[model samples]
Target chain A: MSTMAFLKRSPWILHYDASSCNGCDIEVLACLTPLYDVERFGIINTGNPKHADILMITGGINELNRAVVRNLYEQMPEPKVVVAIGICAATGGIFRECYNIAGGVDKIIPVDVYVPGCAARPEMIIDGVVTALSILEEKRAKMTGAAQIKDDARQAAGETT
Target chain B: MTVNEEQTTIGVALEDLTREVKALQTDGYRLVQIGCTDTGGAYEVNYSFDRGYQYRNLRLTVGPETEVPSISDIYWGAFVYENEMHDLFGIPVNGINIDFKGTFIKTAEKYPFSVTRRGGDQCRNA
Candidate 1:
């Protein structure tokens, strides 16, 4: 299913607050406000992981939220993009040395874009989401290309038979 | 706007913890917070209470392996902190109303805040 056209028009995003101090989460919400208007980029914030094409995560993964984060990532369909917002999600920030923190989101799942800030600014978060949109398109293109290659190989085998 | 906040700390024996907490409850003091500190060989547990503008802390210093009685019976909401103390500091809290049994704040290491960690490896050289 080549949903690249649809994804470009409206890519759904799921925002997960792993262990953030609400600083980054507030900034993410700010992006949605009229001042930033993140939705202008054809991005819609979603609640269900299954419906999400982009996983925007704030804060570093911890023991408790590790499994939850992994499960959410797995539930997202292929050609998904992960955006690690803020210093915490990128490098565990100040909580890296803390006992519970398991470090960046990339430790558990693959991250495509990283927005670096203590509490990432609204503009930065919007930029990260826009960057994730391009990555998501790239992943979709790869998925379709892989399918095309497999189909071509099958067709060649049939012709030989 | 500045307000005068009076604070006092009273050392309470482990055995008398329940009695003192119960007295504070009867006196209509609201349970403010429960905090634990890893003080070398011992764990200092402080239970703070607030009434009007006055704040009082019941401090209990017990051995690392000592079992601390749960104040949840009096404050009811104290189970949250009691479970945290048990999970984070390795302090065995007895008779908690809702006990998670060391699963409260799941950490990478068991009792990570404890001075003597379970494996005794993290801060040995630090």
Candidate 2:
């Protein structure tokens, strides 16, 4: 089996509440409960950025948390996915015009999926995670394909020598 | 025992602020909060205190440039509100126990709540 198979089997998620009113954060938590049971897919909720495969951000980017969001995004490994879990993370929602809000999660980091809701429902969050898994696999495939091209170039150079 | 009480607000002169806050402290009142409102370029600062479920407020209207003395010496935790007031309204607060120097709220625009809100982008290291 390829590494992509393992990637699909287990995907670690990191949830960050950039500037949410706790409405989206609560829904994100609801996804973890037995009623939703996202863990059934072998998706684990992680706190450390380095261990996260999907960044599930729940709020808009604010001046105070912009640096924090950037730091967390940078710390995550390559070929990772980001899911904007609410309208706030999608376009800063109602706070887009606020003085402090910089904008959505995409303003600070690349977002692979956007789940739209004032407070995203747990079902929607699960659906977003499922969507993020596909994006993560695509990114992983692209990375491996590039490596294969590099290896072939090296082999061709060896044959010429 | 009855716990009914009415909220009382008394206007105070800016210079008499420290003296008035000290009196409240002596009377065994705990500082509830310090809130500032921008009232047409000037500032209305309200000092809220509570003693036995009774809410009392001291209101001070000061010019935009007036320096407000910090009541942190009396309440100790008043520095939080003082710093917030200064950061949001560009109000000058003197002698805070711990001053963040306009870094209290980490807003994108400095004094964003001020009538004349001015300043460049601000970002603190995470």
Candidate 3:
């Protein structure tokens, strides 16, 4: 089913905190505040992974949470976008030196948008969400186009036979 | 919230950890946190117990094959820190109340902070 129209109006996000300090987490919350009000962009933050079109992850990947991150990413349906918010999620930041740190979110999963900051600013996070929405749209378009091409090829083969 | 206060330190062997921790518990001190610092051949594991403003730090210098007994029996909260020691330093901190085992860290390198890491490895022996 083409849920592209539904996804366009409401691209819900699942926020996952891997191993970051509260700095990046607080910034994410800031986006929900009246001042930032990210809902204007047709965005909503949801806890459930199944409901999320975008995955907003903050914090560096560690060994234990690597599987957790992967599971959440896999649970989200296709045409999903991953937004790695903060320096930690983008590159592991200072935590990279720590023995337990695996690295950035990209190390475990594909990331479409990266919002860089020690603790990413709310504005940057909003921008990242917008960017992710665009990427999600692009992916949906590509997916539908590929399906159309496949259907056309099957039809032509049946006609020839 | 920074304060300058005198902190007491007591050196205890790994075997004596459980007994000493029990004694501190008897004195009405709360188990704060256990810290493990890598010291090449050995690990200096510090257990910080507090009663009000005063702090008493119990330090244990343990090496490979030395199993630091978990004092989780005395302080139920000791498991978290002990599990950390188990995951990183490979100290084999046994009898943990909430055993995470090696599940504490999600890193590429196993026992990355452990002194048991092979000699002359790029990061180790540096």
- Flag the better candidate by TM-score, 1 or 3: 1
Candidate 1: deviation at residue B63, Å? 1.4
Please state the error at residue A140 of candidate 1 in Å: 1.6
Comparing 1 with 2 on lDDT, the higher-scoring candidate is: 2
lDDT per residue as tens, model 1, B62-113 = 9977878788888899999988887777778888999887666777787777
Scoring model 1 with DockQ, what do you get?
0.77
Interface RMSD of each: 0.9, 0.6, 2.4
**Residue B112 of candidate 3: its Cα lDDT?**
70
Please tell me how candidate 2 rates in CAPRI terms.
high
Candidate number of the best lDDT = 2
Angstrom error of the Cα, residue B95, model 1: value is: 0.5
> Which is better, 1 or 2, measured by TM-score?
2
DockQ of 2: 0.86
Candidate 1 Cα outliers beyond 4 Å, as residue runs: A1-3, B1-3, B119-126
Off by over 4 Å in 3: A1-3, A151-161, B1-4, B13-16, B119-126
Candidate with best DockQ:
2
Clashes per model (N, Cα, C within 3 A): 0, 0, 5
Ten contiguous residues with the weakest lDDT in model 2 chain B: B117-126
TM-score of 3: 0.82
TM-score of 1: 0.90
Best-to-worst order by TM-score is 2, 1, 3
